[model samples]
Structure formats: structure tokens, C-alpha cells
Target: MGCTGPLAELGGGETVRRAMDVNFLGMLRLVRAVTPSMAERRSGCVVNVGSVVGTAATPWAGVYCASKAAIHAATDALRLELAPFGVHVVKVVPGRVKSGIGRANTAQIAGGHGGKPREWGMYREFTAAIEERARASQGAGATEASALARHVAERVMRPRPPREIVYGSLTALFAVLAASPVWARDAFFARRFGLNRKL
Candidate 1:
């Protein structure tokens, strides 16, 4: 449900559309299928897993960030909408839990280059940075998947589950950045993602 590439590249629109379809629409489809039965029973919980990137935009992974942001916004709306039906909707914003997503994304990006990484014409100089961004979430400091699962399960099982669960590494930092002024946030990310220099 993620893609890594410069938004200015050719065919970027298709990339964004694909990310949205898979990440956002895919969730919507599942929610639609289950919400009806839950509404009828007047009891059920829907847990949506979002990401820290959704809170603050980052370079290279704009499509992924946008899709997650859609999830976050939709989850918020669904919470209020489903409240009347006794169906609880929880938004889980995970920072970086250990997963194979990084490798998978890397492979996808490299698939068109004869099993090697491919760089867009205009972004050739930024290839390494782009690859780094693709693997950023799989760092050693990332949260353990099992731990995140346990925490989420315990909380969701509570009689009164929280409306949102923000967990994992960099979640707090991303939350703060999300609240910061646009200019400041932009400066921080620009420097962090190697966008501070002119190409």
C-alpha cells in the first residue's frame, strides 16, 4: 500500500492514483462490507491502521503519505458516523513497526530496472535519498510488530476503547510536526529528506 518516487516524475499521477486506490479505497471497501452487519447488531469495532507519515508529509513518499492521510481523515469521520450505531471506530497511527514493507517497496521500485533500482530522469541525483526514504520505516529503532499488536489488541478489547491509538517510534515527533507551523515543518522535512539543496 505504499510507493516511493518523486511526484514530479512522469506517470506520477498514475502512481498516486494506484496508491490511493489500494490504500484508501481498499480500506473503504472492507469497512463498507462489515459496517452493515455491525450496524444491524449494534455492536462491533473497526480498527484502521494509519501511519506517522500521514501526520506530516515527507519527500519521495508523497503518495503513501497522502493515502494514509486519507485514512486518518476518513477514520475520524467514520468514528462520529458510527457512534450512533454502537460501532466503535479506532484509528491506529503506527510509527515504524518492524515489517517487510520496506523490502517489498524497494523491490517494486527496482523491478523495472532489471532487478536494480531505477531512477527517474530528473531525479537521478537523488536516487540514494529516494531509496533511503523507501527504507526509512524499517530502521533498527522501529517498534516490534508483536508489541504493537499486543498493545492494540489490549486497548481495542477494553469496554471503552480509545478513539485513536498513536504508537511506535517517531509518532510523538510526527505529531508535533503536524501541529507546527507550515513553514517550520517544511524546513525540517526539507533538511531531513535531502531537499534543502538545489538540483
Candidate 2:
């Protein structure tokens, strides 16, 4: 989900619901869809693909961060809920996996703004920065999904798996934010990424 969105994809309502549905509800839906069978067997690993956004709020990334934070919360609860049934729940928190997800989100947001003037409040607030976030999400230094996947693959096979494993360096930074105070973290995120600059 890079850092932000186009803010107009659904054509009418705010894309807030869309973001929540995809990033939060979708994870729950998948777990509900699969957990029963695994419980019956008393064996199975459910590694949720979460994000750095789940841990801390980023500039231009409120909705995505909120939804993902819910995902992490759900992952933790589900882990305990399913533990009695012998289902292993591992949360995979990837930092910046270079994937089409970023590009698709960009295109969707960009397309949504077309024909609509840039003066729309949300668009004016987010347009250029979102474009940049998407671009940077795919750029160098962003950890590859395969690397994270390998870690997850190993974790599931282990006799004892971790509750959460952070993959990227930037993700670790977010972890620091997650543990820090609101003002400290907020100020850190706002300035750490150079978000204070003009769009």
C-alpha cells in the first residue's frame, strides 16, 4: 500500500472504507475462511502479511496505517484464540516489498482523480505526495518480498515460530515509533522522511 492513495477510487464515497476493507477486513476474512479447517486438524500455520504501517502512522498514510494496525491487533488476538485449537498464527510484517500492489494503488488513485479537478480538498492534500510515496515504495532500499517470504517460510516450518518478524530496516524504525510516545513518534515520522518539504 505504499504510503497513501488516490483518494477518489470509489467515485463517490471516501476511499476510507475501501482501504479498511482491503487491508483490515480482508485479513480477517481470509483467516475466517481458512481457520476452521486448520482447527479441525489441530495443525496449520497462519502467517498474516502485515506492514510497517500497522505499527506507526506515516505522513499521507493515515487510513492505511489505521487499517493495518487493526490487522496487527487482529493477528495478535487470533493467535491466542486459535492457540487453544493448535493453529499457529504468525504475523509477517513486511516493510517495503517491491510489488505491483504499490503500482496498482498508484494507478487506481491517479485514475480516480482524472476528470476531477485538483482542487478537491483531499486531492489537493494528497495527490503529489502519494505519487511520490508509490514511486519510492518501489525504489531501491525497499526490502524484497521474497526475502520476507523466505523468513516466513522458515518460521512456519520451525517448531516454535515468532509472533512477529520485521523484515526491512525502515520497519525497525517504525517499531521504534510504535514503542515511543505519540509526540515523539509523530514528529519523527513527519520529519524523518522529509515530508515537511513542499509538494
Candidate 3:
């Protein structure tokens, strides 16, 4: 529900701050507030559900990706830092989720696409179709949050647990790409977004 649309001309510093506050700082503040209690117990687990955007910065969604990327990095470090104290930090990253949240965010961005009133006129056809396609594409299940909860629960009970764990198809695919060379990963997403420049 708190996603952005591109039409807000939301490119200024204030907009950036608003996004960072909600997407990055909001989670961070929550964790910070909770950490003291977790530390006091000397045994706690924190699982942060992030997005593929966090891992892979997508075009036209730079701010979203940036926030996500920060979370990923923070989670990774926090996982290690928390380990010795019996606190576990796990990050679950998913992709292309047919979520109302995703739809809302995409629509938000699409609404702001052209950047200005005059620019909107130019972007009408493209933005309308993008919105339509976005609406049409939601509702498939690429991930199961309940299953993710089970996995996290299992991790919590384990005497020895992983520092970081990803969930579902997006995580799996990203892992495959990660193991491969950079060029291959580049080709993969390039093909996906039709951004491959084969001139």
C-alpha cells in the first residue's frame, strides 16, 4: 500500500526522504527498537522479508531498489553481528510477487511516469498500457509466505542456523545467477526486461 507511482514528479529530495523513511528507515527503526529487548533476552530471531529489488536494482524503480538494497546489506551485517549474542537475523528476498502491495506500488509509480503535466500527455499511451498490464499480471503465486514462516521457525529451533536465508523462486533464481558469472546474470535480466542491447 505504501508504494510509489512515477507521476508525482517525486524526484526531489523530499520525495526521496519520504520513500527512505517508509521503506528503509521504518523497518530499521522497528528493528532498532526491538533489538534492545532481543539483546536483553540474549536469544531472539529477526527475519526481514525484503524484495528482489533489494538485491537487484531495477530501472524506473531506482529509489525502491536502493532502499531494498540497503536493507539487504544491513541485514547481512546485522545477521553476523547478532550471531554471537544468540540473536539470529535472516533476510527473505522474493520476486515478482502477485501482491496487492506490489500492484499498488507499481500503479503508484506508473501514475507518476511522465514527470510533469505536459509530460503526462506524451506518456499517456505508455502509462495506460503499463497500468493495464500490471493489473492483469497480478494473482500468480511465485512465493508462499506461510512456507517461509515455517522455514524461519525451523531455523529458530535449530541449534546451528544460517546467517541469512532467502525464500522461494526468486531467491532460487537469484542464487543461480549469483553463482554464475556477472555477464551471465546481466544477460538474464537484460532478456527479462528487454533491455539487452544487441546492436
Candidate 4:
């Protein structure tokens, strides 16, 4: 299952919870719905589309990143659980594929659906950064959705699909970030997202 929602400020627990529900729990539900049949048949392939951001949390989109991280972890667990049943689980990590997510996220932010970042207690000055993060995928270098879909389709159809697939723009960047030390990663993201700015 591949899907994504907007980037929103986690002003209260509700926003975070909602993001988790959509990104992580939604995948859980889909898996639950199909696992019984797949188990019975002793054959099936479950493909989960995650994000490179999930590999390492970034400044403005922490909640979204957390949700994707949960997917990665859960996908790993599910792969092991379904192995005995001859089920294959694949995790697709896309960095930034061209899609409507950017527009949707921008609209959500504009509609103040997640929260008013400008009104946030500690994150007020960084709202612009948050907005930028939400819309970052729409940049020129984003991978085409059709291309990503084709690549994933071919991989999943293989006799033994890869447990994890990383593709798209910024995948390499996120890979470097994922391999970096926590302190270094945090510092880089903070500076990039303007969290280090003194307003």
C-alpha cells in the first residue's frame, strides 16, 4: 500500500495521533485484511511504500517521519512473521516522487488543518520552514510517479522480491543522513529547516 498525507505541525497529541493512524495504522489494517487469505494460501506478496524520511527524522515533518519509521519497523517484523507462510513482504522507500501530495499538503497547511504553525508556542518562527518541508517533494528533481510505479511493479513480481527498495530523488541524501551520527543528523536537519534560526 502506497499513500501519503500532508505535513502538519504537531501542536497537540491529536495531530500526531492522526498522522500515525493514517500512515501506520492504515497499512496495518490493509495487512490484517489480507494476511488471513495469504496465510491460507501459503503464498502472497505484501508491498509497503514508505519514505526515505522514515530512515531518519527531519525537523519540520517529525510526525510524518515517525509514522513512516513505524512502517519500516513494522514491515521488517511482518516480513519475518510471514516468512514461514511463504509470504513475501517488501518495503518501498521513495525519497520524493512527483505526486499530488505536495499540493495536498500545501492545501492542508493553508487550511490550517494540522495547526497554525505561526501560532505554535515554540515553533512560530519556523512555520515557513515547515511549509517548505511540506512542499519539498514538488521540486524539479522529483521522480515521476509512473516511473516509480513501474520499478516497484517489476520488483514485486519477481520470484523473491527484495525486502526493501529505496528509490527516487534525495534517496541518496537520506541514505547519507541515515548513516550519519544522531548528533550530526540533528544538527544538519535543524540548520536546513531553520530550526537553528534565532528570531
The most accurate candidate by lDDT is: 1
Write model 2 residue lDDT over 1-199, tens digit each, in one string: 4336433442324467777787788888998999999999998889887788777767655667677788888999999999998898988787877778676656655655564432335456655665666566567787777887787788789887888877874776777888999989867766755556565
Q: What is the alpha-carbon lDDT of model 3 when measured against the actual structure?
A: 0.63
Runs of candidate 2 with Cα error greater than 4 angstroms are 1-14, 112-119, 122-127, 192-199
Ranking of predictions according to lDDT: 1, 4, 2, 3
lDDT of 3 by residue, 1-199 (tens): 2433243444655656777788888888989988888988898878776776676554345576678888888898888887777788878676655457555655455444655322234334345433443343244655565676687678756766666666665666666765778788778765654446543
* Tens-digit lDDT string for candidate 1 (175-199): 8999999999999988988989996
Candidate 2 residue 107 Cα shift, in angstroms, is 1.5
Candidate 4 local lDDT, 1-199, one digit each (tens)? 2222223434445656777788899999999999999999999999998899899877667677878999999999999999999999999999889988777766656655666523444556666776787787789999999999999999999999999999899999999999999989989987887767566
What is the lDDT, from 0 to 100, of the residue 80 in candidate 1? Answer: 99
Distance from true position, residue 40, model 1, in Å? 0.5
Residue pairs with backbone overlap in model 2 = 6-109
Give TM-scores for every candidate, taking all chains together and pairing residue i with residue i: 0.94, 0.82, 0.71, 0.88
Backbone clash total for model 3 is 9
lDDT of 2: 0.72
Error of 2 at 147 (Å): 1.6
* Cα-based lDDT for every prediction: 0.90, 0.72, 0.63, 0.81
Q: What does candidate 3 score on TM?
A: 0.71
Model 1, position 9: C-alpha lDDT score: 82
Residue 179 local lDDT, model 3: 74
Q: Residue 95, candidate 2: how far off, in angstroms?
A: 1.1
- The Cα error of candidate 3 at residue 90, in Å, is 1.7
